[model samples]
Target: LLLPYLRNKGRSERVFKDRSNPLEVLSEKELLEKFRFPRHAIQQLAFDLEEKLRPETSRNCSIPSLLQICVVKMDFFNISGFPNVIGAIDGTHIRIKAPSTHEPLFVNRKGYHSINVQAICDAKLRVLNCVARWPGSTHDSRNLVNSQIHDAFERGELQGVLLGDSGYPLKPWLLTPFLNPETAAQTLYNTAHAKTRNVIERCFGVLKRRFHCLHGELRMKPERVCNIICACVVLHNLEDQMLEEPALEITEAGDEDGSGHYIRQMIVENIFSA
Candidate 1:
């Protein structure tokens, strides 16, 4: 219901086994009568959230307040060897109307029609950032351009090594697998670091497994899509924050090699020509 839109979409999208839309339970008259929401209230809430989120210092405002809250609230992603721990980044396919003329935007490199949504999440699997306008054809590496990640890195606003699958390349500030070999020693070093970075992967799994709504087509304008995603992430983070569970636990038995470096390296090469 509106509660998911307002509260728990992030932590438990699949909490209800009944897949039927809850709104359908209402009769037609009730739907007509009750579907109306407080538009002024919504507008005021949006304004308040924007005020809390938008910066007074910069005219540039591609970022929204909810996303800004996600960034500021990233105190819980305990990525090893890194700090700030904002999120792990990746892309997902969202079904969309076929482009009227810009067919290439909908046609992904994988030979399908979809919109690519790049997202970042913290350690507890709450989405912290999202970019929705990129065509499905774009590579995750190339997609970073014109993105907040690009600006954040340029501004030195990002401090931690973000976690990702093999689809991203490695940089000093951004973490990825080895692009070239320095040695067996170098390879091991990267593997260990990457294992530490897999929290982002787990974050993706946790969110997707919970929110089946996100797993399907989301028809909305590009900007609204970004807001919907941020709202869900904040809602998810709120759930985790409410829970008293531990953030992460350290284990001491397995070899760092448990996560194959070979697979990770191939991901780096394919995702980034780096």
Candidate 2:
């Protein structure tokens, strides 16, 4: 009787272990399908959660776990060779009903009534900052220039470079690709910049896909529409998991710093030069 009970207990333990250890048996594609993320991402998640899931030794002696810190890894450099890129910034037009007061202001270059939503996102397509108040007629550069984030960057309150397109002016913290590639390094820099900046475009696509309301015209007041857009952005960030604040790399802001040009040149030499 004791021998049969021991065998049954061993079989149950093996079954439980096999059920819990899917990573060991699942292929990369299967892992992605099951977890909605890649194998490495799942591994990273496991690594991040190990401490939080660890058993507490005694009452009141357990270390407080910060589950939010798991999302801090930007890994933007992994996609493109560009270094220190914390965010990618871009503006997308959100179609909305014609406003009664500022109907003309809402008419975009595409001849559609829309709101120009400026968003900055991390490598993982998580929205870091979003501005949905600007009218469709506003230029992308103008919207960014008038935004609080611009002031923050100017004040050196934030760190890491933001990858933008030719529509945005280059700064110490904001990098745009070269229109005319004069040399091999400049060409390489442009290639990396384009690849890196493409993340913001993908981010916008994912956002619109996740929230189908954004694909069609929003039949509401501009103010209400803005609120909806902001809400969507917040939800998108929550889905991706919020990242920790990046460490600041302060730079002097004055007299339209031409240091951007110098910085670009240095990046071309150090990073792009092969």
Candidate 3:
């Protein structure tokens, strides 16, 4: 049912014809009879799988492993002329059903209900960290600031700088592009920053393209939606590590909020200008 549904929704192409697989040609009633499970039971099973596979930083990640990731990403950026870059950070909105309470909080500037999911990805297209509990109304910078990854960086527990876009603040630990590059050096810096930060955009694209549920509206509750998003991210990372092929190619949606624009400009002028 899921396979036929994905193909019908135009999320993926049919891999097998009706003649090749009798199951693929079965009617909905026939399929249901073969499965012998109710719709609600399938949903419950999905939820159980999500809970079992969702990524937990403490359980799935370690300091030594993180340092190894940093070293690999740093080398990748170094070849591109961006020094000490560990990861690319960005946010994408996941559409969800409107909530019963505080509906306005879920409606984003695009006039849709969603959850803003922030993720940091390494050069290898692996999700190093993810935060998916924030409402779509929340700014990307605020979500980052409130995340455990931010606290970790603040405590100097992590090494190297993160490459972000202009929507994020420029800190000693994080680098954002120059808003208006007037000089050749600033132009060069902005070019490098954009090129390096684009990895996160591609990461999101691959994730959404692989998970059709995320590409379309998720009808589940907000909390359940968050769980599904995290579960998908964990699965995406696993697939990337295993070098699995992607199902489709999807473009990324762009977002911009000037939460730390002023501070970013100051850092660019004081440091990058020199």
Candidate 4:
């Protein structure tokens, strides 16, 4: 029901009515009759379960433990021919219904209402951190600055650098790709950066593929939508750890902001020129 509803909410109610029991398919009508409950009740039960089972990131990866993540990530990057990388960070837009108030703020550059969800993922495609509450109009850099990861790094609670796209700022703890490459070493740096950063893109693809609800426009309030996103992230991480699924292919996406361009250039010279 969740699958059908998420894929096409308008046609879901009629879907279960058309299938037969002999075909090993129970129509929506049959399930409804057997369960003796309305469709809304079932949906509500699923949401309740999700909320109850939502995994807490702090339990698995606390502030102090983040340094350990840095160690693991650096080793992972070494295997991939990149160095000193802790995690890959990026933001994706999650479509949502326009709110009654401040509806314009929810409209993104793509002219759709959404939530700008920022996430940091490790080499194994596990979501290390997620921030789902920001409106679509919020820039990726702004979201990063407000994220718990950023706060932890700022307070010296976490160590190592995170690789991001050009959309993010380049600080001592955050590294982004070069805007343009005029030297062979800079070109090599960009190549390695792209390869290492591709993990976050694959992570998003796997996440959206597993949870169809995120593929379509979420028909809930912003707060509920954020909760659902967080729940899905928890489930994705659990599945990633437990299942032996095939690897996800890497894909590329562009970034917009360059607030830390100068900082990025300085770091690029220091690392790649050596």
lDDT of 1 by residue, 181-252 (tens): 566645664564565556556765666666666666666654455556555544555457567442321110
lDDT tens per residue, model 4, 206-254:
9999999999999899989998898887678666656854222111112
- TM-score of candidate 3 to 2 decimals: 0.69
Whole-model lDDT, model 2:
0.76
Candidate 4 yields a Cα-based lDDT of 0.73
- Candidate 1's clash total is 3
What are the runs in model 3 whose C-alpha is more than 4 Å off?
1-61, 65-67, 244-274
Show where candidate 1 strays beyond 4 Å. 1-86, 179-182, 219-227, 244-274
RMSD per model, one decimal: 14.8, 17.6, 11.8, 10.6
Error of 4 at 137 (Å): 0.7
Better by lDDT, candidate 3 or 2: 2
> How big is the RMSD of model 1?
14.8
Candidate 2 lDDT over 48-99, as tens digits, reads: 4453223323342322123322232246777777887767889999999888
Candidate with best lDDT? 2
State, as a TM-score between 0 and 1, how close model 2 is to the true structure. Answer: 0.69
How large an RMSD does model 2 have? 17.6
